[model samples]
Target: MRIPLSDDNGHQYRDLNGNGVLDPYEDTRLSPEERTEDLLGRLSLAEKAGLMFQTVIEVGPDGDLVETAGRISKSPTSEVVTGKHLNHFNVHQIATARQAATWNNNLQELAETTPHGIPVTISTDPRHAFVDNAGVAFSAGPFSQWPEGLGLAALDDLDAVRRFADVARQEYVAVGIRAALHPQIDLATEPRWGRQAQTMGHDADRVSEFTAAYLEGFQGASLSSTSVACTTKHFPGGGPQKDGEDAHFPYGREQVYPGGMFDYHLKPFREAIARGTAAMMPYYGMPIDLTVGGEKIEEVGFGFSRQIVTGLLREELGYDGVVVTDWELVNDNHVGEQVLPARAWGVESLTPSQRLAKIIDAGCDQFGGEECTDLLVDLVENGEVSEARLDESVRRLLLVKFRLGLFDDPFVDVDAAERIVGRADFRRQGFEAQAESTTVLVNREATLPLASSIRVYSENVRPEQVSEWAQPVATPEQADVAVVRLLAPFEPRDDLFLEAWFHQGSLDFPPGLVHRLSRIAEHCPLVVVVTLDRPAILTPLVPFVSALVADYGSSDAAVLAALRGRIAPRGRLPIEIPRSMDAVRASRADVPGDTENPLFPVHFGLTI
Candidate 1:
């Protein structure tokens, strides 16, 4: 086979756009047959092996998540970047301009190697605004600033979503990112469920609507020179947990549908498929309690399930794109779909190696958030995995990479990226989104739009911080409005949550604090904005505030915009905010979000 080993000396690659040079404007759309032949012909066995993995990235000097973040480990990112062959990388965070440059330079060098040289498919979690989680790790980095998904959802404008996705794509492509790891489209059915705001809203219908629109925005209307591919996530619907907790934690891993009454949950995935999403990610918690043919199936995410991915998505939905398992969960390496546990058992049972094998065999084409392609190569060499399997995945991956036009123009125009990303127009759009998304919840006293002369006090916000709006105040008596920013409680844990039962509970926040704030709100017209990861019980504060906004993911811009009326508030609540803790506890824990005793129904929002 004619192999393309080095960047400059490979004939296996042919320039597609008929351009004499490999420039940013090259077009890579191929007829299905032509695309297959090109991708196959360009990759040698070794190179194809390299394309199977979509690995995790390390941050900082300390490679461990437990220690300091923002550094790459000496092992793979250092090693993989050196050998110059990788399919995908999910950056932890680009800490410095130097780090960003180095990472880009590595991918750039790799792209410069082959005939139809493919650009590295880099991706990231949310990086625009506040509450950076499994996506970007560091607070300070070379990032394009914007609002979170909820903030974007609040904007409820197709133009704004398009702008946000465009900027994100520009920022990513500039730094060699071709794939976007999110637009987590799961419906936030349960309010107290962690990661609720990450979605567009609670209704499957709304979530479906927003996700379809977002997929278009993020990926662009088509896979052209400038558009980045959107990876729509948590297939077959991920929300409706037993306790509104994430499945990443053990206590929240069980997915309950309540006798399959909500059988239409997969409505969004069907839409995503119809909309031509570039990729799919199975969530950690979503597992069908029943089994096909009478075997108890247990796995964290749906991507790892054949019943979910192969049977439903590929066979029924006719989706011919890539399917990758959620990070940290798919560790078992499989032998003809027979999954085995992992190698790194640090008080844990499985290592990533074993898990990797199983997931590949189980029909997962790519490994999301993995850092080591070498591991897959090793397995292939050791006779544990097959070359055909690797080839299968590589072909699918390369197809998308080709579709992304990475094969032609891999290098990012940093200047263009800067110009397009985080532009004043986009930021203004985010502000508008926040305002529209923010629902007042209550306006009995009509205390909203407090005069510029009114004072405010908050737990997280200082008196001086509100000085721009009004004078500093010492007590609730002195303030005309008491604005509070509350944080969602959490204890970051592993994706599977294979820990003790007690430790596997939903995030805990301070008790009776909302009530205390309510007392202050009762006296004065107050606006409470919950800066949280999950839904908070708000019955206590209902009587106190004239306006309320669940500032999803601590989007300060969204919060500010809503209050300032830069954009009209229109975002319906993504989850039903409960009335009390007892109500939540009394609801079915077996089927967390599937329960109907919500303090507030889905899309419950009040406006001034």
Candidate 2:
């Protein structure tokens, strides 16, 4: 079919009386082919650039931002979210079906207010499980729950990942969640990272495969049907941080690639791009400190790196999709905050107009963490930015909307969201994943799956939870097997840190708890399951127990399913579990942020 001529395709220049030179904003009556250009020509420069930025979930307001260099300075001012024009709208904290519904309505309110009525595509961080991060808000919400990424990793089943994504889309669609902001395919190369729970399991090939499958489900073949837009994130992969710390903060932004993990880090991304991912969300970290561009910046990860985004992702990988910034505008402590461009705040050196220009030139289609419209509107009237550019972005954004079938089916099924948003099937899926995700790392004497009647003793251990797998007992003398779940211990970096990551910081484990558990392990074959979100250094118990398991229990049901052997344990450790803490500390910290560590390279999953 010959495509009709349109302004977007340069067909609108066909006017016999038209000037040879293209106008910045065409005001002519455009044919169907010339409509895009004509519309774009009508926009002033400022309106063109504003389409590229977004407001965080709660930051949809306007305030008196001191205009320095034509930019708003967010030094500290009261702002009210009055604009409807936002590239992305993040609604964090998925509380309940009702809450999600309400949030959806609020987002629609903003969408309806856009200049062209550009619907605010409400996106969410993972909301299926207990991620334990309250500040990010979407960790545990009203959506139907699923096993976290680790659980999916354990199953090592791409089909399972796809099914899970389909289910998640259902829940999201139910509550008006049009876009999903995850599938962090970054390989887990650093074991100490407390945040690997959200990633697909630990192998480049495996992660890539599952990531593709997950995307397949999220972006179905037909946009006119059950499809949800998804953003494959932390582009180029964001796993190899210094201490497994996220690149969200200054401490975690330096991507050291001393081990040369950069090349390997790109596999999953390659796969994701091949699978037709609609959107890409770059992380806050940049490879400035590494050889990515053979340079070092004091801070700022790849999110703003024009080299990485335009030169690499666009030119190298051939990804012609929309690029959205991470949540930088939100003052939230969990996600990156200092991430918003200095332009968005109207800084003195680089005006807001300049910031918007740089972000667009850098290949960012939308500015996340923001919802400002006046700034862009004002700039357009002044002819600082071109309206044609805004039209370009609008075209891209509209394409995604078209792909998601939002133009035809925008509203979520209020009834379905109520019916199946948190249905039993989803819960069962979580349990199933849990069982498959868990791994029995050590079982020297074949002491696990203890006899029905066996004595067990352990402090802070739930003997009853495992009673079905083996016998529960008061004394260590009579138990046939002892299952002790070890809680990894660590000291918080500061008061605020503990308050944000953990529910209670002051609570201390009873002393000699390991010693007592060791006695139980010695009495019978000991099976130690470490219920940790992050790796809790388990070397101390290596010699004491016969078996060890790392559940990283974001989903207890998945853990339980893994224990039952209903699902295969395919989740290889995303990051290397050091034999000792000293090993990790001695290793080079300057690994590339994009690739995997050869130390425990990607796809090292072992099957039992």
Candidate 3:
């Protein structure tokens, strides 16, 4: 066990400085601001610079510290913490709940041995969701699995959203995870936007209300030791991509406002700001030819745009929280065959050092997915970036750690972690939520509420799970009813590293898919469940299918439960199902509910 020291008032504290005395920065009685001030005064320029980069770090097999570099993490865990002094990390890929807690303890033990003894603040993308996109979110490996963000929006229940968030917080805190890199409030205004599965939906008012509940759930009444600080993200909106392409790649860098509704996108963020979110992240997309409030906004990415970051978010909106940039805006990522260049967007011509200067000047507090503290230290030493400016960010960062009680104790009980994470009650609630969020778009002649005695032909569903509800047949021709699950269509691209993971491009079902489903429909009364990661064009299959349904990251059991009428499908269309791809092309990027003749409008659903 570790030893501690006591001050004059007999309040015990960690001897963080290792000088055998209680330092002002280590005092538990002092306010976070007071502790931050004392710590800021003591930190060297290099140490302060390290706090600005929140990078990825992987755990070793059996929950040990990673001694060597991995595919995603640039350096080993020890190098980043002890050598480079980076404390903030986004952890990925844990085998079990115990492993996660052990890894965190090992990491904090390492941090304790460092010069300042600053505890690491671990953050994660939405891990409870079913979609496992490495660039966006991970799978629910050891946590209770819930539907994606769109499913939560489909439920349209503020109480349910709050409950999910609160449960997620408990699971996260158990594993020593202190920050949530989510509650992604970006509205799905653009139908073909690839990242819509993680968004709340297309409506501004509903998204705003949910955003408040989400913040309350994660951060609790306020950010405390038990609470998980949420980084409500993609500021100034990332949904209005030009031609519906993502900003991760160079070709998709432009974010247009053709409908001139730029202000409309900021509605949810206004709620996030009002709810006191712990951090905010600017997106990679650069606004194109945009003028706001009679002034022309600069055509730089929001991460490097002072007009968006400092002027709009900080000064205009009066948001004083830590502003973090989207990942890897300053450095190129080259992992084996996969190569992703830095997302500098409009300022692509500038060097990495110059880009770093610009990000700081734009008033960002941290650089996401970056580990170039040496570059930042050099910038400050060269007078390109001021030490005073570094202090401004470091103060905010340290205060968060202090407020989280990381200074008091960063360790968690490994036993408690195993018990609390993915508890039986939590899993039951998640499965129920999944079933409740399944939207019945078209059910002709009372085709749904399937009888348990009916013969079933399953596609993209587990045979054993299907056997639980109805007789599972080998082929559609052998069954009385056919159940097929299809993912919303997207144009296939293998050029970019993370492009395959992002379900982008066209929403129209490919010609081959239509032909295949047509064949299956002929064999029996078809029951098609389309996973709506993006708003899909369902016009071709509308006439042929007996029952049409939509799901956002639900399990086979959950979907089957709804199909069997064990649970009712209460979800509605969070976004409209467009009539055709032509309608998608003609619609404005910034406008919601703009699809000309949608097959199914937003909030459209059928009950049995």
Candidate 4:
């Protein structure tokens, strides 16, 4: 199990390729750029092609390598790493910190056996938050749990955001997760968009400020060994979703800029590039007859648009970091009986191979959630994509690996991972953040900070946790007050793989639910708390409810603490709460704070 070491002038280095002499790429003292160039020359065409794709890889029970392909992953871990020669992977879940460390070490061992011994660079979506949307993000498992991204935005504290990111970095680094697929900087301009919870609010300036702190926290001052390279995502802004529909499906592929505020969304990205973000991810949405600065944008997905990726991001912004496409842009995803088609958008007619070639031509470095090294290799052999072009991307990818110190040592200490991940201090801080992010929107007649002796009729509030605050009654009639918890309403759809998981469509509460809450208010003063994943229309409930509260992602305990004055609510609304669905429809998708006569504007919050 001992990795053989080579020495050159008393400096020992990992003999990655099993060659006796110390290769220039294996030299520890050399700069990343120099080492990248040395390794670039040594790589075969197939090896270089493999570096262009990053796919999903699931860990087996107890950190064992999966022998078979998973539901979402197209190939097993070994087949993708060794056979396909991929070095980057997006890990789905980690059962435990020690197990994650073990899995990472095992994966690196597999990579070490390869011809070049390229260590795998593990990445993950935001996993320190609530909500377990499989394709988007996973819930915290053996990791310190924190509020969702919107909760952090609700707090709007740069120091707090930096602390959270640093904690995440420590946890990720312990388990050998080098890349963080997050800090989703897309402004929540459209209230009905499903992915709004993952973004900062519609304010460009605040989002831009938070972005600098975010990059600083995740990657430190710069991306180094101690850092988790942050991929500030959905570049050129994915906020202006037409009809508030996501671009993951064919129906929601249009990203319109009807307000002619196309440059407005690019504000945070400019900050990201300035802060030295490790990577960028373009959204699946294609501009729909959109014009930016008097230039008509090609009606292709951002991943396939040369004007956007090459001309705008690369040339104009001068960003040389890796550019990864959103998931499944070239291949259709097969989930059970249903098939989630590729998000080719304007270029849907192109073949899978053609799509890959175009993405490369568009100046992308790697394919997200894809494993098609053979296809890329064929493209090079058939003269569609030149090998020199592949080097440009591969070189960037290798530089990131080198700069991250992966080439020096990829293995992690299993014992250290267990001790550092989900430590008591980290968990306590996360719980406090959850409590602090509880935004009290309406407190009519000072209804909150309720007496502990008061009898409470609870709905959706946990009976055991509610008992700690006040007496829990079976019916509203037997109680002095009613405490109810509700999620912001969204129209349900189950067409695609992750469609149902994403809370898309209408933001209006159902008539029946509103009627039930109104009836409860007649018995006693009602305290209704709704989790505002997206800004929900609260016009109907505002009249009937005695007290209205909003939270991004909070636990029952956190809410109870805020209600009982144990922990005061410090959160403000990050985005406006629309008065009605009519106002939402009339507002420009690209413009911020454009809703007419909003019930509660951005940064609106109250104390008990």
Per-model TM values vs. the true structure: 0.81, 0.77, 0.99, 0.99
Candidates 2 and 4, the one with greater lDDT? 4
- Tens-digit lDDT track of model 4 for 1-608: 64778777899999998878889899988899999999999999989988989999888889989979887778888888889999999999778998899999999999998888988999999999888887788889899988888999888799999989999999999999999898899999998988988797888899999999988999988778898998888999999999999999888999988888888899999999999999999999999878765788999999999999999999999999999998999999997888889999999899999999999999999999889888999999999999999999999999999999999999999999999999999998898898888899888888888788889999998899988767889999999999999999998899888898999989999999999999999999999999988989899999988899998888899888888778888898889999999999999999998899999999999987
Please give, for residues 129-172, the per-residue lDDT of candidate 1 as tens digits. Answer: 65545432222135555556665665556677776666666666
Could you give candidate 2's per-residue lDDT for residues 1-608 as a string of tens digits?
A: 11112363444522111344434222233232244444445444443454566544432222112222112222121122223334455554444676566556554544444443334566777877656563332454556555568767766677888888888888878777787788787766665555566776446776778888898888776343467777888787776677655554445555666677777878888887888787898776555445555544324446556777888899989998878877652233332232222212212256545555566667777877554456666655677756555676766765666455443335554556678877888877765666666666665755543444445544455545556555557766776665556555544654333234632211123448667777776677777777645455555677787767766454433444454454655555544555545555556543422232332333344444
What CA RMSD would you report for each candidate? 6.4, 8.4, 1.1, 1.0
Superposition error at 294 for model 4 (Å): 2.4
Q: Highest lDDT, which number?
A: 3
- Give every collision pair in model 4: none
Candidate 4 lDDT (Cα, whole model)? 0.91
Each model's lDDT comes to 0.60, 0.58, 0.91, 0.91
Instruction: Point out the higher-scoring one by TM-score: 1 or 2.
Output: 1
Give the 10-residue window scoring lowest on summed lDDT in candidate 2.
63-72
CA lDDT, candidate 2, residue 170:
80
Error of 4 at 157 (Å): 0.7
